[model samples]
Target chain A: MTQPIEKIETPKGERFIIPIGPQHPALKEPGHFEFTVDGETVKDATVRLGYVHRGIEKATESRNYIQNLYLLERICGICSHTHAMTYSLGVEKLAGVEAPPRAQAIRVIVAELERIHSHMLWLGVAAHEAGFDTLFMYSWRDRETVMDLLELLSGNRVNYSANVLGGVKFDITPEQAGDVLKGLDFLEGRNRHYLDVVSNDALLLGRIRGVGVMTQADAERLGAIGPTARASGVALDVRIDAPYIAYKDFQPALITETAGDLEARFKVRVREIEESIRLIRLLLEHLPEGELVARMPRRIPAGEAISRVEAPRGEAFYFIKSNGTDTPARVKVRTPTIFNMATVLSLAKGLQLADMPMILVGIDPCFSCNDRMVTVREAERAETWTWNELREHGIKVYQR
Target chain B: MSNLVDQITAGLKTWARVNSPWVIHFNSGSCNGCDIEILATLTPRYDLERFGVKLQGSPRHADVLVCTGPVTRQARERLIRIYEQMPEPKFVVAVGSCAVSGGVFEGCYNVMGGIDRVIPVHAFIPGCPPRPEAIIDGVVKLLSSLQSPAPVQPIMGPDGGKA
Candidate 1:
């Protein structure tokens, strides 16, 4: 499955193939990457994912709308809120209902707060990949502020199960709002210091500056989204382009950098942290007073609905189909990582093998988020296995 | 005198292993909820290293295998291989709800339920994704259990067989 492409063969008879994962130290999740390198320079790269594929889409069909809400939230722990929110917004659309204004505003607050946690998490991971443990430690140490804020709003630290069918599960009190603001103030200062270190610090700049330079044209050509494309000067943000929920009232200031290098990705994300801080503050100041959840019917009408929202990494998309039953007919999730994965392959060529981790982390690749399906292709035919067939096949293999 | 020296050496080795238990984390098929929290345990706030639990890169050098999520079929073989690679007397800590009992991912076609299906798990930290403190407590308890007079036997599977 991880065979190196033959077409990109080098002039030399012998090729140095480096297979990175499925279980590599650099990657926290399970993914397989085969890079064809010429001495230290990479000539071609191919990635094989599905190591962390849990069949969440198939699982969603069996579960009801409410159960699926929690199921989808587990798609990517970093962007768990985005997944739940996207699914809920689509389900609510299918049900012909909208969450109350207060619920919508609270959703935005949590989403932005999740974004802060995600970006900080990414910053730490990227720094760790760069061998800058100091920045990694400091950034993650401060990330707890946002994590605490999320916990304060909703109970859990990671899953946060904040979204339900038509609205959110909880409302932020005046005291919780005060706590969130205090945390954000502290985060804003730490993020500013991080921004300075990532941009101006001589040692850190050496590892990031001018490395993995993905031009704006290349980024757009390869369908790069989120901070990865924004760093390349592509002004594609789901919040700004199509306002959903409370985004229509509380808009986020676009943060983009023209460098399109690893440094730009760092800058754009760090700057966006400040931007998210401002958006959360504004939303808290004018949080609408209303019901948390609107009335949603148990059985949704037979129809199809699409939901799109800006996740921390990029735009998270969902397609939900209902059959007038309690359970959904089908649920298709297209996470942002899939869209941005192409950038890594394109950028892999002509770069040193050492810069691979930095380039890979630049897109914030989430294997679990993107590994939704495995298409088995055979010679002269392609086949789709039914649930029963798949189960039998699994049983047969395990029995062997 | 030789028997006494051997006992003292074994005691010293246990003390060292308990105090500085190196861990290697693997996401078998998890949502990464547990993986990140496990990471949080190491960072400054939680400071899991205070107990000398270092997150290692290679399984060969690790003392404990920190497994997250339900074991997916694709990752099961690799999980077994990783568990096998660690030096003998290794401890496996299954973190998160998915890892313990497959939790919400129980009926998923691709999921193989818990990590214990493929490997022996010494400690089970049950949470959707357990909090860092919970993870810390789980590891600490696993370490302290080594202080027992008898060696802990591997938990048997339902079929009364070792994985």
Candidate 2:
């Protein structure tokens, strides 16, 4: 497997271009990568995305705010709540309304729970990518504990549509609060075990330690964010930097590691899960009392707003513009995966071919979250179309 | 005597296909909700393996093709190619509302409707993303249907004869 894939004679030495994915066993979703290697070491890498592109942002323009909430939530399954929450926050900002304190606290609680589930899921997937099925199975089996808690609270496993326009859809009952606390207790213990395993497991350490090392300067230059950056000693977290929802009141301690390798990424995410558990427990202890939702105007005034939230992967950016109507003029989503993707491609150089999967999953890249736009180039010229032009072209093509 | 031996061998093949189906998952244009749930079904909790299901890495080695989400324009050719690569007597299971009827992504420009729009499906599991248990139930029903002494027909969608 470590053998160079496609050999080509270059000016300096023999070069090899290895194409992976768009359909490959290593990738669960479709994405294409062409990595140029000199022997076993990668020299350059290029990524071609858009296979999972469903034109969601364009589709958002045609739907009203209420409908867009559900549509945007599908941007990512692992971080579905982050998409929904980020969109809701942006739309609420434009409407000049905020959820009540109690609702805000509940939002934070759900957000933290989502972070735990997301991190554990990433841990399982990363372990699986490293060929550690035992760790994968154990982490995922334990992840169901949080999944059941989410199902209990929101009535669905994935895409828990927990947020409404002005506030949340469901309130946490006292019994549900007790159940959440019980679940946290179990997860807290398991997370500690995971932290120990990842930090000390000799077999896993061989694959991850000192592999895919991106220094602090490289991370900053590559624009890495979330745990991928924090693992490299960059302390940039949206919640801590600009506290949204109830994060201001109940702040979770920042966790970072300076190793800047796959091991650091694993440690940071696992420790963050421990932090999430503690934060959720604090929110439940001082559970505020109030209505879950506030009235939102059917027609929001014309305005544009930007909202940023720290999703489990990284900072999820949302841009919303209203045109004095129920529907939005435009909607843009910049997921964290795109920012972290550069780090992986850069780190791929000087590493063994066998380490690519581990390095790729180390960033927790979600291809579904990243694929939003497609660029078509034709005959040395690229044509950019406006809304009207694109509409007309669609009509012409369908008519034909 | 030769005809009798052939009948017994064919019967054994049918029984093995029913008891254990090696499935290969393809994500044409899904939001990742259905894809993850499909993986969850194979994990320890839901444990679809207990029902003799194994997730194969290659389409050629697979007996069933489990597709998620609406088929996209870029992925359409690849989907058909994967379906064609599988050996004879292959089954397709379309999971999720999008795969069955294009759900939320129906009118999206790049999306090409449901999986059935590309390849014929034998079972359709519906949900925003069907629960792992429902996925298991769908696969089980599809396998059990093989017990009958008749060839399985492709489950036709609203617009039939696409296959």
Candidate 3:
């Protein structure tokens, strides 16, 4: 059913206000954006997050390391495993214990599988927003293949909770390895079809190409991470740059696209799915043999460690400070979406009202992962102009 | 004759509500897991739509308020606002362990337990992220209770506390 959302015309002047939700249908999560538009062109945009804030960072301070594993996993549903794994990695670093090589390999396997599942889910949602429901249905249907593989290995579908304090919970069996390869085989064919469709489909290309084009310089300056930055040729994949965990052994090729439009972001994600499939197959072949868990102390020594993992959206950074107690003193998370919010707010300026959803999903915004409420001493607010200056300096940026 | 017509129309409303329940989903505070699983049910595989349950985008058009997550401080007012906006005879199905009891987020600074902490819940489906099958079953269970044509009350007490 088509939405009957009415755009009110201000009788005083031509300026119209379009507020897109704390409960609008353009997105699955709640992050409100108000755009002051002139006719069809967007003049200015403002983003208000924290609609889904649950005070996870502060809550982490109270829970012990063992319980916080599951707590942190719920930070973002799509990348729950990445949250748990990243937290465990940091805590392990502080504890001065490395997970067994086999466990590390398992971490990469799960992470890549998650990357595929997440990107596929995003593709379906983005397609649905673009009014192409067929692709949405098709991609989601194919996404189940990877979801099944994840469930087989980790037991749970969404929050795998696979990472233990010192190592992973489950190990891959021969049969599971067979299933992984089988799932990838089916996904490989589907990924190629999707890549072709996103690049060539006339209607899809029209809605995406030359729309929300963020230059490479802009992407870099804005500090966009993951595929959002890679699409603009920024090359900021944390896996390659930092070589965390199994990234050193099973390296992933950085998928970059020169064109930074919505299409480029789409291409970067689709190509990343292809690369994840390749990585999964190789990891399955190597299948390191070792214990899944190492002996970790109940009380971690007093120290601080920062861990970064390449979540499907972008880099998921976790900062853990242990104060010689069972519970951590502070746990800080800087999700990729928070970094891309600047890119999104900037791109939305001067865009048509129709382009807001595309540009918003272009960064694959995850509000729950963000809203952890980190007080950045150095981070400055961009363009805090109230409604007074919103009219005179309502950014007129044109994309060629 | 007037009494008979009134009875028939009320019965029809009950039947229509049970037959096709249009649902509007809200996330007061959730880990996106339950929300995504809820979406998974709408897709072709689980096919909750086969039961004639449509996930409506607006609360105004929805018959059931399907909420996930524990209520958070910031989202409390918005959740209640969405519930209040829906027409009377509305049912609420809170899906997920979090929606049922706040699950892992019970004592967090901003979390206010489950969806029931703010509004009344007609049905509760429990899982870390409940499976699509369980969610379908929960909605069906809620619909089963609405088979009788009693005027659905909001069930708030005189003291503004949960009844």
Q: TM-score per model for chain B alone? A: 0.95, 0.94, 0.91
Model 1, span A1-400: residue lDDT tens? 2222233334654456655553421122346666776755778988775556778899999998889988888887788899999999999999899999999999999999999999999999788767678988999999988888888889989888889888989989999999999998899889889989998998778878998998899999999999999999999999999999999988898999999999999999999999999999999999999899999986899999999999998988899999999999999998887677789889999987667767877898753222111222222222322222222332332232
Q: Model 1, residue A55: displacement in angstroms?
A: 1.1
How much is the lDDT of residue A350 in candidate 1?
A: 96
For candidate 3, write residues A140-227 as lDDT tens digits: 8888888899999989899998899999999999998998899899999999999999999987887899999999999999998889
For candidate 1, the C-alpha RMSD (Å) to the true structure equals 8.7
Give lDDT per model, in order: 0.82, 0.82, 0.80
lDDT of 1: 0.82
Q: Where in model 2 is the C-alpha error above 4 Å?
A: A1-12, A23-30, A367-400, B158-163
True contacts kept of each: 0.66, 0.56, 0.61
What's the TM-score of every candidate structure?
0.90, 0.91, 0.90
Q: How many backbone clashes does candidate 2 have?
A: 0
Segments of candidate 1 deviating more than 4 angstroms: A1-14, A23-30, A367-400, B159-163
Candidate 2 C-alpha lDDT tens digits along B1-163: 9999999999999899988889888788787888889888988999999989998656778999998888877778878988999998999999999999888988989878998887888999999879999999999988988988775689766666252
